[model samples]
Target: MARVMRDATVAATAEKIFAACGPSWLGDSYNHWSAAVKAWAVGATRSLPDDDRRAIVYKTQELDDALMAARRALEEEDDE
Candidate 1:
């Protein structure tokens, strides 16, 4: 039963995540799964426990930070 519940959760998460990826960003290698997963994490689950929400938020921040770094690096390359 626990296994079945876990599988259901995974399926639901995947569906929610799939709904998140859209309006395509420029110059991105669109991996639908990654975007969907991120969206699922930051979406309706906002009502989860503080620790869970915080973890998701932190993950989002980390991804944002990485993207900013990548963009800066690209800009520097363009300048050179």
Candidate 2:
């Protein structure tokens, strides 16, 4: 199905983005890189159908939240 394929493609792209820009304790560089990736994702998905675009946005937000949580955990560990 086209929708299934679109979902798979979005998932694959999310994985690559996460691998390349996952959270780190590097502060500004990490923030900048994450922002850049987010922008790139938006641009890349601009031509997708509405549903596909929404799926990618949701996935991206999910990944971003996970990365933020991981970063917070690392900071907590460092603080202890």
Candidate 3:
């Protein structure tokens, strides 16, 4: 379904963000990259109408989940 595909895209984007942010020590205040990415993602979707914006709530959650997974994977890689 289209919704599923869209969620997948959102997740992939979050994963990339996690990987890209892993190398930088952006300070404690800036450590919440997942949240920052979600905020950015949501804002990026603001051009959509109210209903469409509402539709991506689940997509945002998917992005958050993917971000966490990516973070763990990166940490494990560093441990290797």
Candidate 4:
């Protein structure tokens, strides 16, 4: 059951990531998508009996931070 939940979360996250970043896609904007995905992942993780929520939350935060940093770098370049 834990494995199943993990797999589902991964699949869902991948789908959302692609929708947010892929070309020719029609989904939520990147900011909204990120927030929504984080919320959904946290809610889903809460259902697990084991202590996997910390890992998920950590990874999500890492991803968001990395993306924000990259975006800032790109914006700075664009302004130059």
The candidate that achieves the highest TM-score relative to the unseen native structure: 2
The model with the greatest lDDT is 2
Poorest 10 consecutive residues of model 4 by lDDT? Answer: 21-30
Error of 3 at 16 (Å): 15
Report how far off residue 69 is in candidate 4 (Å): 0.7
For residue 18, give model 2's deviation from the true position in Å: 5.0
lDDT of each: 0.46, 0.60, 0.50, 0.51
Give per-model TM-scores: 0.45, 0.54, 0.33, 0.44
Q: What is the C-alpha RMSD of each candidate to the true structure, in Å?
A: 9.4, 5.9, 7.4, 7.8
Q: What lDDT does candidate 2 reach at residue 54?
A: 54
lDDT of 2: 0.60
In candidate 4, stretches whose alpha carbon ends up further than 4 angstroms from where it belongs are 1-46
TM-score of 1: 0.45
Minimum summed lDDT over a 10-residue window in model 3 is located at 22-31
- In the range 13-68, model 2's lDDT, one tens digit per residue, is 76676676664334334444446455665667355454554565566556666778
Residue lDDT tens for model 3, 9-69: 6556555654554433333323365355546556574444433333443444455555567
Model 4, position 20, has a per-residue lDDT of 55
Q: Which one wins by lDDT: 1 or 4?
A: 4
On TM-score, the stronger of 3 and 4 is 4
Candidate 3 runs further than 4 Å off: 1-54
